[model samples]
Target: MTLTNRQRAVPPSMFADETLMELPPPVRLTGIGLRFYVDDEGRGSATPALIRGQLWPLDTAVTDATIREHLRALVKVGYIETYSINGRKLLALTDWPSVDRGSRSRLPAPPSTEPLARSSRASRETFAVEGGGEEGREDGREEGAGEGGRGPSRDARDETEPSPFCRKHQPHGTDFACGGCASARKRHDQWLRAEAEAEAEGLAE
Candidate 1:
């Protein structure tokens, strides 16, 4: 397997995650180890034999059956998701934290599901920060902004422009407010709320 110089971050909240704590020790360890193996897009091969080879090459006791059981447990708790593309099984870290200065993955994305405000690319661009998780700069400014007086950066301008369409809400024009879009946004808000609650629980502990 080819490897890159990408750096990955483990959120502190991970240790306090109740669901993860309920998993068996070996399965939990395997889940954590798999995070390091995923590409920038948080995806990797899911075949049990291949996963065993990649994750436990020198450990004779770690059989392919053990790897498969661990994968099943991780999938059960939604720590990771497994899918197939063109008959090749693959796995993606469901909530993998973003890495700074990471290169884009060459791996194919998992099949599309309900469109969320935090699209796959957007999720990959966001990193967890102390106090709370926020995207881009804290002051609501794009990175690399010049001090001298200037108009909004290209990125800022692009953000202002309306998105044409997304996977689930496709074919809708810029002026249309499709129900699918609204439902996706609602689900995204719920996800944000859950994340905030999780973070708060971790902080309290």
Candidate 2:
């Protein structure tokens, strides 16, 4: 399917969506863009190349790999559901509301046999910490530590290490003044609050 100029509604609640808020900025933007890019029934191609071409044709910076990463993030948060149909991968929004105007989607429906891999709230938070940005070092080693440990040893550094640095705020030298880290902390606190409220509501119901 090709990209179309179809108009779609953007609900105000989208801005307050906890799951979307937890994702990286680029991933969140891509998720919102996909909402407008999909068909009336919220079905669309899952191919990274097609997604990049459809959503970011003019933007040279947005690459297929970037789109793929964004899509993976979106799927993890349950903003979209991906499935394979006859070996062709497609995606659909998990909670697409009914629309009156357009015809039904021509895309094949997702199979009912397999369950969608929607991450729980705790898992989502873990994912954010690990993959949200440059916060957590993959190797668990400081950047530029030599092979022979010329710099501070891991045990010595662990005692003085502050919060990890965010992608935007880096090389702060063990300081907890990173704006990205602050923002991430705020989002995480908000998620905790929301989870508590939701649990309370569930108990009351």
Number of the top candidate by TM-score?
A: 1
The whole-model C-alpha lDDT of candidate 1 against the native structure comes to: 0.60
| Tens-place lDDT digits, model 2, residues 8-33 | 77766667665567788888778878
1-205 per-residue lDDT for model 1 (tens digits): 4433444556665676556667888887788778777887788989888777766778898898899899987776556778888898899877655666666877677654333334422432342222133553446543433232122233432343333333444555234433234333444555555445433433454
Q: For candidate 2, what's the RMSD? A: 15.4
Q: Which stretches of candidate 1 lie over 4 Å from their true place?
A: 1-6, 112-205
Count of backbone clashes for each model?
A: 0, 0
Worst 10 residues of 2 by lDDT: 112-121
Candidate 1 versus truth, CA RMSD in Å, comes to 17.7
